[model samples]
Each structure stands twice: as C-alpha cells, then as structure tokens.
Target chain A: MAQKVAILGAGLTKFMRRAKETGKELAFEAARMALEEANMDISEIDCVVMATAPDMFDGVHMKGDWLSDGAGAKRKPYMRSYVGGGSGVFAIIHGWYLVASGLFDTCLVVAEEKMSSCMPHPQGAFNAIYDQFLERPLGVNLLWIFSLEMMRYMHVHKISLETIALVSVKNKRNGLDHPCTQKGIAGEYTVKDILNSEVIAYPVYRLMVSPVTDAAAAIVITSEHEAKRRTDNPIWIEGVGWCLDTSYWTNRDLYYPKYVEYAARMAYDMAGIKDPRKEIHVVEPYDPFAYKELHHLEGLLLADKGEAPKLLEKGFWDRDTKDGIPSCPSGGLLGVGNPIAAAGLMKVIEIYLQLKGEAGKRQVKREVKRGLAQAWGDLMQVGTVVILSK
Target chain B: MPFKEFIEKLSKAKVQKGDIPVWHLYTLGIGGDVFYKGLKEGKIKGAYCEYCNSVILPPRMYCEDCFEKIDKFVDVKGPFIVVAYTELYRDLDDNRLDIPIKVALISVPYAKGGIIHFLNPYQEIENGDIVKPVFNKKRVGSLKDIKYFELKK
Candidate 1:
C-alpha cells in the first residue's frame, strides 16, 4: 500500500505584467518562503519538482534545468513536470507520487512562469502549439480557439453573455482581498461593463481574459508521519488525478470538458468522495477565461451539464453565500493573474491555505473540510485535479 | 504490389509549410543587467558567491551550487583561457562559408562559468591559449559589444 502524503506549507509571489526578478529569482523567492513556512531547510528536502509553461515564454531552453537551482534542487533528485497550463496542479500530483511511493520522504514542488519575456505578447507562443501542418497554416491562436469553446458552451446551454459575465464580476471582486492579485483586474465591474468591454475574439471580451503575468508558487509535501511531526495543521493530500485527451481537438466536442470529468472522477474515487457538490466545500477551478470556470465546474461533476450558469445566477457560487459552494475565492486566474503554470499552482495553494484556516479575508462563509483545485490545458485536452482536506 | 500502391498514394499527399512568428524581448534580469552594463564599459563582470568562494561568469542573481542569493559584483579583469574552440564552416542556412569562423569558450580566472564568443580569425588559436577581449568603439550593453578574443600580446 502507498503511504499517505500531506502538504506542510505553501508560498506565492506577487502576480504582475512584468517583474524585475529573473525566472530563477522568482523561483528562489517562492521556494525560500515555502521552506520558511514549513520550518525546514533545503537539506531536509529529499527531492525537488518544478513546473513551468513553454520555454518560449521564459526565453530559455531547458528551463527546468535552468530553474532547478532556484527551486532548491541543487544536488538533490530533481524532476520537471509539464502539461501545458495544467502543470501547476500536476506538480503537486508529481510530488504526491514521490512521497507516497516511498521514493522520497519529503518533496518541494515549485511552479514558475515569466510570460513577459515573450516580446509583443505571450499569445504568440500558443501559435506554435497547434498542429503544424494543419492548424498552424491557418494562423491559429489561443483567443480564437478558446472563444470557439466558450461560444459552443453558451450555445449548447442557452447561457446568456450576462450569465457568463457574472464569473468575471465575482472573481474580480473576490480578488480585491487577495494581496497578490494583479492591479486593475482586482476592481469590481458590472455585467454591463464586461459586455461593453473590447471584444478581442467573438464571445471573448478583454475583461473575460486572464492577463498575461509573471509569478511563481511553491509547496512542500511530505509523508504522513513527517507531516504530522513538522506542522500542527498539515493539509492532507487526499487524492490526485490527471487525464489527457486526444491532441486532435477538432474531433472532440468543445461544449464540455470530458477530460476534466475523467480526472476529477479519478481524484474523487481515490478521496472516497461520492458527492462532490456536498463534500467539497470550496473549489478553485481554472478561470483563465471567465466561461472556463463554469465549464470546469460541470466537468468536475459539481454541477449538472449546462447547470453551472444557473447556479451562479442564484448566488450559489459566491464566497459568503449560505448553502453554496464558494468558487474562485482566491480571485482565480481571471482576477488574480495568469502566469500559465504558476497560475494553476496558485489555485492549489489557495485550497491548501483555505483548508488550514489561514486564508484571512478570502475564507468562505462555511467551514470547509475538503476542497478541490482543477486546472485544464493543452489543446483543451488535459485536466489535472488535486483534492485536499483538513 | 500493395505496398507500392501505398507508397504511390503517399507521394501525392499535400504538404503545408508554415512558421510560428514568435519573438522575444527578454529582460536583462538581476545579474544580467550588471554584466551587460559592465561589458558596455569595456569590462568583464561576475557575481561573487561568498559561500562557494568563487565568482559566477555570465552573472546570476543566485548561486546554483550554494542555492543562496548572490548580490556581490566584481570586475574579472582576466587573461581568459580557451577551454574549447570550434571552427564553423557553414551558415545557419547550411550554405558553405567563404571563410571558416572561429568560436571559443573562454574561461575567466576565479569564475565558475565562461562565455562563448568569436575568436580572432587571423590568430593561431588552440586549447589552453590565454586570450584578451577586444571591445567595439561604440558599445551597446550586449554581447556584441565584445568584438572577439585575441591572443594576449
């Protein structure tokens, strides 16, 4: 049988458009903060795992090796996990494997991104991620592809633009309490404002998109016994699951994220959670785009197909609402910032902090026992899930 | 015959050629800024790591060996050693060059790392040769500011 794994501490750097620190510096800061929080030194760590998005964004080839030193890998066993944007949540899952499988007693997982290094804009990096012979010739980018998914989702569910806009309103307002949230995005906005915002791609407004950012997040994981000995409130990593679908995204239905459902089901089964809507108190689903949060909520099986938007209208996903599952209470990527892989890991750290009762102003109204953080990436083909508990 | 038919069919398939038009605007970063600025001033600089008791060339904000923040900067006025060298006979497009260009990995004294740059074409270069950097008159804070390395006279 595998040993249990738990998170001892978490850390994050401020999210912004540009950072004076290099990618290594950002990784060092987050790793240092996490080690300090865990009351441990680099020597205590048995292994190190890093997660970062495309090399194009950081402008460094073999970025994992380049960032290993700052991530506290040094002379220790080191590994880099990549799943596009889902890499953040996958980093924790990778750490869980190291500790639970008895390969390592303790692991430090760090996720970093410096999207600003990509000149003009980071979106250019997404251009090459498509099928070279087929999709690249058409000049495909993330905005149009994600806009297609958002439109299909709304068309299938009969959701209004205003309903989708609520996610932006709520997440941005929720971000107001988060100290690391990006400026301008943390302010409150009305549905009218969002609807009236510049439409970069059809059905995708400027307000609906997560801003390009640079940041890093880190977490320390250890075996059950080690965790208990180290921290008074070690958040348990109850379950971890990830799934990847076909790279040929044109063959699949964009209206739903079947990959997320598969990943979440695997996690829920391992966590012994049969009813996520009730058992899971808080969620930080990937919200790089406003509609993606609702789309992922349904994929996680917390809501029925096409029902997440209706739930939002009832204030069911608000942070302070009674009898409702608070979603994106950390402001999410939509409000906080999207540094690709770092943003995904930030969501997992938010859940870890919330379960530990350390989330000062962003805590939900209900006391939580279990929470889920899910990230989706690739050509809309990968899903990663991590379920944490007090 | 069946295999031949498959081969004939594959030859007729359409091929689409394209390129990703992505560019980068990398920041000099914490240590890079200092090193590049020093290069513009016709000097070589490295970050000093007290724990490692050595200087890091191509300066970094943190020492990879010690995994600690390094903020100390020092001038490495060196008789650099030629650790490695290669002669390039082709351009990026694989066209034959009119004359072979010489490149060498030069290691500075008291530094853990080194820089790779062009060597003087007229010089008889060899491994373990001591060299000095030649800077351009109008210098920009870039690697191009250091024109090439030549034998120490």
Candidate 2:
C-alpha cells in the first residue's frame, strides 16, 4: 500500500530573463502564492525542500542556507536537491516522499534560479560542467551538444528542419496566450528562417533553443486526507521516477535517450500504464531544445520510437490540434521560458491546474484524467519523470 | 606625519609571502585510465559496462549501479551524438575567444560514458555523424592532449 500523496496548490512568479526581485524575494512570492492557493499558512508546513540550480547562477555561495528564511524553512527540516534542470521535477518527488512517508503531513517545495546574476557570463559557469582536466582545454562552447543531438534526431528519424522549426514557432505562438511568458514572440517563422538564422552550432540555430531566464515556482503537497479536507479537487501523484546515466556523455548512442526511457518505464509501471500512447491524455516533455521534444516524446513512450516527428508533421502535438494527446499545453520552456529549476515545476503546476479545470486560457480542450511531466539535465544524462492523476 | 608614527604602523603589520603549493595530479577519478591513456596514445578510447551494458566515453572506472570497475577500452568511430550543449559568445573576462569554438557531447558506441570534445573550426559535424579523434600526443596527461575531433568521411 502506498501512502497517498496529492498536490494541494501551486504557484509561480512570472518567468523573465531578468527580474528586479532578489532570489529570496522571488522565492517568497511564489511560496506566498502557493500558501494562498492552498488556503493555508506558512506555519502549517512541516518540512521545506528548496531546489535551485547552481549557486553560481545567482552569484551566491551556499544558496540553500541563504534562501532558508525566504522559503520559510528557518527551523524546519531544510534540504536542497539538484539534478540540474531536473531539479524542479526532483523537488516535487522529494515533497511526495515526505508526505507519503508520513514524516510530514504538509511540505512546501520551492525551486528558483536567477541566471542573470552570473558576472561576465552565465555560459562561463556552464563551462564548469566539462571535464576540468580534459574537455575544458579544447575550447568548447555549449551549442555543440545540442547541434549534435539535433542532427541525430534528424538523421535517425528523417525529421526535416522545417518540422523542427514548427515546434519553436508553435510553442512561441502558444506563449502569446500566457501572461507570464517572457520570450514569447508573435510572428511568422519558417524552417528556412530557422535554418538561415545565425548558426550557433552546426544543425542548431539561435531560435531553436530556450533563453536563460530568472524565475521561481512553488507547490504544496499533503497527505490524501489533508487534500480531501482542503480542496474540491486535488491532483494525486500516481508515480515518479528519476534515472541518471554515466557522466561520460560522449560514449553513448544518444540518437535515443535510454535514461529517459528507463525513467519513464519506471514511472509507467508504477502508474499501471500499459501503453502510454493510449492511456496518457497529456504530456509536458522537457523542451530545452526543439528536437528534444521529439527525442523525449519517444522516451516518454508517448509514441513509437522515431514516430514523434511524423506526428508533429500531422499537427499532432499542437495545443489546439490534439491528436489523441495534448503536449506542452502551457507552452513549455520553449515558449513560456526556461528558468532552469522553475521551468520543470511550472509543467507540474500546469498538470495540476488542468486537472482541476482551473487552467483558464491555457486550458486543454480534452479532459486531462492523467498527465506526464518530465525534465532532463546533467550533461545530457539525467531524466526525471512524473505521472499525475485526478 | 611623524616618522615615529609611520614606523609604529609598519611594525604592527604582519606580512608574509609563501609560494602557492602545486601538485601534478592525474584526474583519474572523474575520467578513467582509458580517457587519459587515449589522449596519450593519439586515439580516442571509451569503455562499455558489462553489467548495465551502457557505453561511456571519457570512460568511467565503475558502473553507475554495480560500482564494478571497468578496465576494457574500445575505440570510437565517431559521428558522436549530442545530448545537450550550449554556445558561449564571450569568455570569462567578457572578451571573445579567437573564434567561436564548437564543443560537443560525443557518444561512442559500446562505451558506458560519453566523451566531450572540441569540433574543428572549419569542419562541420552533425549529430550521429562519424568523427575521428585528433590528438596532440605531446600534450597527453594534460587537458590539451585531445586537440579536437574531425568529421570522418
């Protein structure tokens, strides 16, 4: 018997490339919003788990301790868990374990990242991911990884540049409906436009990737009994899984994401999903890069391997064009913005709101009985997956 | 303004200089012996875990789960797979590098880990394309050993 875990409320600060608020302030705003939505007070939280990407992003050292007060975790059990961009999804998993384990009845999970504070360049801190004694000396930049992946997805699946560009155009257009979208642009773009756009790396264009953003998001999780007493509708955590591959990123056949597939399999098994394509109604696969959506779609078992791009060509993944499933209903990181840790949880929040029928304008037309959210991080080797149901 | 006062100030200060301690360390922990040796051998080597059966470049000493030490090294014929990468426009000092260099997450088949490498400036390599490692044998044991990877015909 599993301990019942449910999301009581969720909140987020506006996603922005740069924010005027301090890290603590941004966290406080989101935490306050979650508490308000839950109709509960900060004093009610038994445990607090804060998730933030590198402290270097904010130019602050020992960020967990520095942000304890702002997250309302001064004296409570405080901890920070990070898996790079997957930290947001991992944070909710931590909160679920706390509530399910009966150690805490209510938990406050917060994730925030301020990429703007890095002095000189945020890309500099990103360089630290490479081998200090090996890869760092080769004069490597970041775009190389995405370009390679994009090329593989294209080569293996026979996906065209035009098909990939449609994803960026679609997500950005969908973002126009989102009030919190920071990079949302209302314009017409073609595959040629993306291909011709300044090549950041071979096979990757400037418009295909998400921009660095500063933002915060929060969610409150509680036991089944508490959720029943607090809200009319509570989104339950049906399953969760996180898996990491070797840090040696260059040694694997990345044409497919085995790590993501493994994580998704663990989640699907726990959720009692036989065929994800037939069972899951919505998806929010991580889209840090345009091709990643297609890469992760297969990893999520949302479609047969290498079949996602074909579906995309048929207008299958469009928010308005639901082909058995709706994906990135909230516009995703591609459109809503990528604030590192906050972005993944925002997808979680979207699932919660859609299930509760409170997603207002960004709401999907179909009933969202069960949904999946995933985030990838850590040298392209880590994948975190979650399944939720109402 | 008195010499006695100035002398007193100088006398109270404790100033000492010491040479910065240095140790020549082989980063055999993160990147395994195959990785270091490959740099020295002028060939790219990766390891495949027997248990999890995953390929790893910049070879790992142990499988992530079994924690079993891996000793076998295999050569990679690239077109490396790109997992996730970014491009930096400027250096740490906010100054541009001589040129925009391409860094990649190249995956070697039959290896448990991926080896990150630099792409030649004039060359264009796509994800999943075969590439060959270009090594500077003299720089082996140092980070600059594997100069860059070139697209394989």
Candidate 3:
C-alpha cells in the first residue's frame, strides 16, 4: 500500500566508555562511513533524522540542532527522535516513513550518544527520570527499579540467576568477534563471571549490566528502486512498529512488557508474518542488562511470556549455530557497551550487516533471510522494532 | 583518554563541565495538589475510575487505560503491601553507604499505582509484608511528610 523502502548502507564507530570525540564528531564519522558504504555523497541525501537520548547525557541542550552540521543536514530537513533508549530504531522507523510516504527518496538516519560528559555518572541524570516531587525525593538508584521488575518476573516465572546469566555470557562471547566493541567489558564474561561479579541488587550483577558508553551509528535508507540501483544486495525495510505504554510505570505490571509485544505485533502485521517465533530467524532485542534481552525477547513474541529463559537453556538461540535462532549476534549492548539511542541503532545496523552477509566475524553461521531488532526504553514503557530482509 | 590528555592540546579539546545552576517549576495538577494536601492531614488519597474499576494512588486526573476522567477521590486505606524491595549498597557516585539503604514499592491492594520510596531503616521487610507510613512530626504536604514506610505491627 505504501512506497517500498530499503536500507542502502549502514556504519558505526567503536562503542567506548569514553570517546575522545564530541557528539557531532562521532556523528560525522558514522555518517561519512554510511555515505561511503552507499557510494553516495552527503549532498545527495534528501533529509536527516537524528536519533539521540536525553540532552542531559551529552551535557548539551538543543542536541538535534548541534548535530545538524555533522549529520550533513546543513540546509536540509533535520529531525530528532527520543524515547529514552528506543530512539535508535525509532529514528529508522521515522526515516522509513519519509521514504515510504513518497516524501523523499533518500533519508539519512544517525544516532549519537555522548554519555561520558555527564558529570558524576550517566546514572546520576536518571534520578530525574522519576517524579520530581514524589519518586525523586526517595533518592533511588535506577538499578532498584530494574531489580524490582526482575524480582517480580522471577517470582512469577521462578527464573533462576544462572538461566538469566547465560544471556550475559552469550552476548559477551559474541562481542569477542566484534571489531568495534568496547575493550574493557567486552571479553570473557561467562555465567560464572556474572554470578561472581558485584551485585547491585540481589538479582542484578555489575557484569550483567551494559556499560555506559559513548558512540554513534548511521544508516542510509532509500526507496526500493534506489536501493537496488545503489547496491547489489539491498536489505529491505520490511516492517516497523513503535508503541509507548503510559508513563505511569508504577501502575503497570513490571513482570511483562506489553508495549513491546504491541510494537512487534504491528511490525509483524505490516510484514505479513502471522507468527514471529517461526517466521523471524534472527532477533536482537535490546540488552542494557542481561535480563532485558530475555525480557524483550518475550515482548517480541519470539518466545511465550516467561519462556525465554527456558529457550536459552535449550540453546535455541545459540549464536554459533547454523540451525538454531540467533539473538544479539552483534554482541549487543551487553558486550558492545550501550550508548543509549546509538546502541539501538547499532542493532539496526547489525541486522543490516547480517542480511547483507557483511557482518564479517560477527556474522551468524546461518542462512539469514529476515531478522527483527527492537529497543525498549522509558521506564519500561516504550518499545520500537524494525524488521529487515535481503 | 582522560581529561589529562587535554592538557597537551588545550586549544583542540575544551572539556566543559555542566555545573551551571538551573531551576525548573512544575505546576501540580488538580489531582496532585489534592493528594499532597491530603498527605498533610495524615490521609492517603487515590482516585477511582469506574470504567476500569481501578483505583490509582497519588491520584491522576485521567485513567491510563480507559481514558476516562477521574473525579472520584477515594481514601486509599493502608497498611500497604511491599511488592518489591532492594538493598542499594552505594549511591550514584559509587560511594559505599555507611549502612546499605533498603527501598521498596509499597502498594495498597486496592490501588493500581503505589508509592516508590525508602523503607524504614529500623524495620525488616520483605515482599508482601504489610507496611504503614510513619508520618513526620511537621508536614509540608510533601512526599517527605512520611519519613518512611515501616513494617506494620
């Protein structure tokens, strides 16, 4: 019913604990790589969509405006999308419409995060994310909220720490193959390592958490005809879905992510897939924490509610396998380091590589046809998904 | 590279810290204003949405699911139960607290939204343990009016 859209090229910089580069510099590096991969100059871009998290993380207000020049939006339409960490894939969804609506033939989507600049730590800014009058006065660390949700899920599903720890081990092991990974926390994190790591909340460990990172990623999406003209192998943007539950996090059941399921359903419906569990072969559901990847997997309906941990135990998503489903084969934010919106975009870029057989060492050992990537954010309220196929 | 590396190329790298003072004002809606004032009177306020048959604490103006206007202010009687609890050993700066802090989300069974705040330092609490608000001697109609939620005797 709409104009067909496909990703022409994708590029990203190394995920770092702290990048020496500024946000715009990071954006330009990624944008240049993307344009180069597409073999199209920046001037050929019709519009720009910048995906970034909060301004507090970068310590710069008016981030979309500041990133314009670097993103090559010097005189073109520039836009920004922020839904906490979900902005990355959400930006791609916005770009898909720009092309699918017949508005523009080519759209440049770039997501950048400079979290190191936030003094004290990036976690400090999150305190403001709660109610200023009520929840903030309690002086809660953000981990407490995750722990609350984790505990609720554990109680309902009777999930064990070891089962959850497998996600950390798998993603970190996968990270060893990613060239642009953050060095420190990127290697040799096993289930034992996760269990032995510092426990922030009883169910959550430091090693199980994705690091605060500074990085950026960019992807060029164009009309299907333009994509075929530009590249020999084009990854079609098959579907997109983004949904936000109410901001009242306390009111909802934290044990499940209904919003994520809603987003995935929308994408699957648009892509004409009746069942995600069988139709989709590859999955990358956001992994800011080990449990989150599993949580989002259930939300994506790749597994039934509370069944993702069991799937992990069965090696259903073995990253090295040729027959099993693979999730976060790019190492994910768990190993690559999470730069908020950029990490989500990195997942989009990962699927692009997987579908094009350009993922190099990080590529899954399988006959890849279609894949799903999703990012969750905003106190567990927002879910954004993008599906791509060769 | 750390900030020390900037010393070698001062002109090329300008590291700016966000220390400037900024102030923000929020106008509490009718629901919030009523809830805060009710706290001063040693009362917990909630709203009932008949369409959803759900009660929300720290009352909101509209129902999240049904989108119905909430005009019914109900007193949320508690002894609320602890839904979840966590021990945070350090603050955001990674500083070890002299004594670890215990926090939880206390919920009145009838209400959908509960209070996320500190648990009583003196009480031993667990999930589903009933807790009551220990109000401050002086009330400013703030969330802090309740010192902490204590394990109900």
Which candidate's DockQ is highest? 1
Error of 2 at A133 (Å): 2.1
**All DockQ scores:** 0.58, 0.01, 0.01
**Candidate 3 TM-score on chain B:** 0.84
| Highest-scoring model, TM-score | 1
Q: lDDT per prediction?
A: 0.92, 0.78, 0.85
- Give the alpha carbon lDDT tens digit for every residue of B1-153 in model 1: 355554458778877878656788778789889989999999989899998799888888888777678889998888799999999999999999987899999997668999999999888999999999999999989999999999997
Scored against the native two-chain complex, candidate 3 gets a DockQ of 0.01
> Can you write out model 3's per-residue Cα lDDT over A1-390, one digit (the tens) per residue?
689999988889988887766677678778878988888877689999999888777556788787776676877888998899899999999999999999899999999988887766778777667766567667677788888888888888999999999999999988888888997867876688889999988799988889899889999999978887877878898999999999889999998999999999999999999977778888888999888998899999888889999989988887776666899998999878899999999999998898888889888887889999999888778999999988
Kept native contacts, as fractions per model, are: 0.67, 0.00, 0.00
List candidate 2 segments past 4 Å from native.
A183-188, B1-153
Query: What does candidate 2's lDDT look like per residue over B1-153, in tens digits?
Result: 656654457678864432211112112433345566666766666766776777666665444334344566567656565543345567788898777778877775544557666777677666666776677747646447878777777
| Regions of candidate 1 where Cα sits further than 4 Å from its true position | B1-5, B93-100
lDDT for residue B26 in candidate 2, whole number 0-100: 18
For model 2, residues A84-172, the per-residue Cα lDDT tens digits are 88999989988888888988899999988877777566666676676655676676666777788789778887888888888887777
RMSD of each: 2.4, 25.3, 24.0
List the candidate 3 regions with Cα displacement exceeding 4 Å: B1-153
